[model samples]
Target: MPAPRPPTVPVLEVYSTFQGEGLRVGERQVFVRLARCDLRCAFCDTPESYPTPDNARVQRQPFGAKDEALPNPVALDVLLAAVERLDDPPGLHAAVSITGGEPLLHPHAVHALAVGARRLGLRVHVETGGHRPGAVAHVLEVVDEFSPDLKLASATGAPTPWDAHRETYHLLEGRRKALCVKAVVGAATPEAEVEAAAAFAVEHLPSAPLVLQPATPYGDGPAAPSASTLFRLHRAAGRAHPDVRVIPQVHRFLGLR
Candidate 1:
């Protein structure tokens, strides 16, 4: 019998984009946007990532090159090659960010991709909705950084997954590289909830900084919080976490993807 074929992933797209949020804002990186999500956050900006696309659009070369449409369920090795292809003009990218509708949904593929990216001499970063401890545990060793969100009810339009978030944070304690805990604060976000999230972050993952990202107005989604609201949430967060900063979507400010 023939050997089993390598695993494939249902991908959305692969391209070069700047790290537009959290601690790594403004840093250029290759992005691997995987498809499908477990949660339907009301304020999610990339709702497009929520569905499994028919093809994964990949940029063949850097600097506004036309994207190549590869069939969905792209081969793991092919995905890695696409990532390597974007590294033209050597040393241009600082890292590779694995983002998604919820990247941890594909933990096995994530682990493999992280290993492949690391082998290419690039730092590997993964962003998640902050509620998948089981999946987080599977890819922890291969990943260098974690950007897990502390989902707020006011923002996500769903009950906060406190237990899962706590467990996930605990799993990331003493992490190999860095972790940035993010909470999206909307106009309706409560000070009490923000405080709770801050306390949770400091208590479980004290090493990681907490970032308060003001929700950007999206179609039927949460509206952007006012300057005063942002300041109030920052103060509330700082009560527990020493490092708390209010950052908006920088890529939107710079008109980047």
Candidate 2:
């Protein structure tokens, strides 16, 4: 019998841009934005990426050029070509970020992409919602960095999967320096939720940085957390984790996507 074909993933966009969040914030990287997400955060900026449209086209924006449209359900070779195209100067990118609506939804594709990025002498960074430890485990060996979000029910208006989040954190236990948990805090986010996320980080991945990102305004999302509220959350998180940092979405401030 012939070998089974690798999965073809629905890609939304691939571009060369600055890292927008977490520990690698402001660093230049190639972003592979995949399509589809299970959780629906109220403040989701890329709602367009959440659903796979029938006419969905992958936007390929290589460095120093306008974006070109490619067909969706792209093959791995095609995706790799897009990444290579964006990395024009060849090792200029700090990393190739595999982000998404939820990249882990296509674990095999993500793992393959990570492997390909490593071949090009680029670090592979996986950004995820951290709700699927199994999917994350599939790519752990190939990925150099993991940035998982600790979703809060109050902030996201979705069910919080504490167990899965914990499992994900524990998976990154030994990779502290290369891992970080980003918790989005809104003006209405509960203190308890922030504390729980911080406590988990302290217990499972103490050395890993815990970033409390003030939610950026999107759609009808709540207002950004006030200075006092952000400070309070920072202090609360700091109590549990010594390396807690309060950072907002820098890309939004700079008017970049």
Candidate 3:
């Protein structure tokens, strides 16, 4: 019998762009945006990434050029080629950001991608919603960094469970240098939620930075949080975590996708 091929993942798009949020804000990196998400936050910017159509396709956009649609559930080799095509000198990017509607939803494929990227002399940054701690754990050994979102019910307009996020934070405790907990604060985001998220970070990942991203207005979602509201929320987060910082979506400000 032949060895079974590694299961492929549903990739939505692959491109090279500057990191827009969390600790890596402004850093140039290659983004491997995987498809599908379990949560539906009201402030979601890429709602299009949440659904997996019957004939889903992955868009390959090298160096921000025109996108070329490819078949979905792309193999590791194809994904690496997509990343390589985006690289000007190859292996020049600071990290390969494996982001998603929720990347952890496909842990095995994520692990394979991270391992492959590491072999290519690139750091792997797994950007996840932190809703699936088990999945996160499965790839923790292979991934170099984590950018976990701590969702809030007020912003998501849905129940944001705390257990999984708490567990994932616990797992990232010793990796303070590679861990950044991000919470999206919308115009209607409650100050209490911000404080709670900060407190949770302080309790589990005290050394890690906590980023409060003022939700960027997208789709028919609520407007971005006002400057005053952002300031207030920053103050609230600061009370619990010393490294709390308010950074909005830098790519949105810079007119980059």
Order candidates by TM-score, high to low.
Answer: 1, 2, 3
lDDT per residue (tens digit) for residues 108-212 in model 3: 989988988888788899988887889977988899989888888878888877888888888877555346888888888878888878898889878678888
Per-candidate TM-score against the hidden true structure = 0.97, 0.92, 0.92
Put down candidate 2 lDDT per residue, 1-257, tens digits, no spaces: 99997568888888788898988888999888899998889978888888775433433554345567666788888888878877868887889999889999999999899999999888999989988999977888899988888888878988888899888888877655347888888999877778877887788777678899898888887678999999888888877788988878888877777
lDDT of 1 by residue, 30-76 (tens): 99999999999998888888888889999997666689999989999
Clash count in backbone of candidate 3:
0
- Quote model 3's TM-score: 0.92
Worst lDDT run of 10 residues, candidate 3, spans 54-63
User: Runs in model 2 with CA error above 4 Å?
Assistant: 1-6, 54-64, 174-178
Residue 27 in candidate 3, Cα distance off native in Å: 1.2
Global Cα lDDT for candidate 3: 0.81
Query: Candidate 1 — worst ten consecutive residues by lDDT sum?
Result: 171-180
The TM-score measured for candidate 2 stands at: 0.92
How well does candidate 1 score on lDDT at residue 240? 80
